[model samples]
Target: MNDHDYYRAFLHAVWHDRSADPLVASLLAQPAFAVYRNTIFKGCVDALAANYPAVQRLVGAQWFQGAALAYARRNMPQDASLIAYGDGFAAFLSGLEEASELPYLAGVAALDRCWTEAHLAADDAALDAAALHAALAAGQDVRLVPHAAARWRWEPAHPAYSIWSANREAVETPDELAWRAEGALLTRPVGEVRWQGIGPGACRFLDACGDGAGVAASAALALEAEPGLDVAAMLGALLQAGAFTSFH
Candidate 1:
């Protein structure tokens, strides 16, 4: 094999701990390579931990680190660049049968992942109240374009928002089990990620808006999802949160 091919083989052997295999050891000594391999593995573990703090809190740091280690071993990041290292972690958590008992765990991981993505996403100008008011006054069809990084959806049985928020604070952790499934939105309006729980109606409205539905149609969808929901109030709340970038 060429020198380039040999180097690639050496790296794989070291990273995968195949150095003990006859084919690998023939090229490099095992003891020297093992040290470098351990460092690389630990670095990946640390990166995952830093990326998923809320998950770490939910599962406890020790258990989270352990899981991160295992996850890294199984799914060594394809990219050498660390900026997007944990991109596939939500899927990893979802497929882990051991974590299935905490169904919300995957959701929590997803929310955390979304937060990271939102933070790094391209910046956008926020819509102002005056502009929105004028659109409303003119009776122009208003449609909100949420930030590209925003994630809005409803969960089936987990208070994913509550767990994420409560864990971020230094206060006592709240009882996640008591929380019923709720709709939530995560956004980054000014370089900071924020999470908030909204009603089913609001979620539906946001989903509609996200899909290019007009304001009126979005409101109607919200009301359809929850007959008792106050469409006017929810719209006001979303506007105040700077959830929309523009009205079209």
Candidate 2:
């Protein structure tokens, strides 16, 4: 076999089949090799811990570490950079026996993943209010363009947003109202990640905009989601949150 192919197989054995590989078994017999393996395992655990702090806090450090190790063994990182690791962690948690008791845990992990995504998204300029206003005035139908970093998705199954907010701020007492289905919006404005729970109307409006719908059409969608939705207020709030890059 070629050098690259040989090393690739060796790495796969080290990562996934150490016990079965004679070379790995020989290495396992050495204390130094064991230390190296332990260090690699710990690195994976630490990266998971950092990526999912809310999960770590909820499950306690020991339980979280055990779960992290198991997850790492099952789903090794495909990316060279650890920063983008743990994309499937939420799904992994959802399939776990322990997570069955905590139904919202998986959703919370998913929400946390959104934060990472928002933070890592490409930076882009936002449309000035005056420019947007001028475009709206000139055009019969204006379509709002969303920022590259902006994302809005409603989680209806569990209070994922509330749980995420509580853990993010380390709240001593969480709001009871937060224990319901809510819309989550994540964005990066001025190079800092910001996220909040938005109203259903705003969620629909944002979704419509993302679908490349015009303002009038997006407003109709928002109204369908919430008949009493304040069209002006919803638009203003989204604008203030830096959700839109331009309107044309």
- C-alpha lDDT values of all predictions: 0.78, 0.82
Clashing pairs in 2: none
State the TM-score for model 1.
Answer: 0.84
Q: Each candidate: RMSD to true structure?
A: 3.0, 2.3
Per-residue lDDT over 1-248 for candidate 1, one digit per residue giving the tens place of the 0 to 100 score: 67887767777775566654466776456476667777888888888887888888888888888888888887767778766678888889988887988888888888778777877777877877788888888998788888676777687788877776666564556644576887777777777888788888988988898889998888888889899887778888877676777777
| Residue 39 in candidate 1, Cα distance off native in Å | 1.6
Stretches of candidate 2 off by over 4 Å are 19-31, 173-178
Superposed model 1: Cα runs more than 4 Å off: 1-15, 18-29, 175-177
Best by TM-score: 2
- Model 1 scores worst on lDDT over the 10 consecutive residues at 168-177
Residue 227 lDDT in model 2? 94
> What is candidate 1's local distance difference test score?
0.78
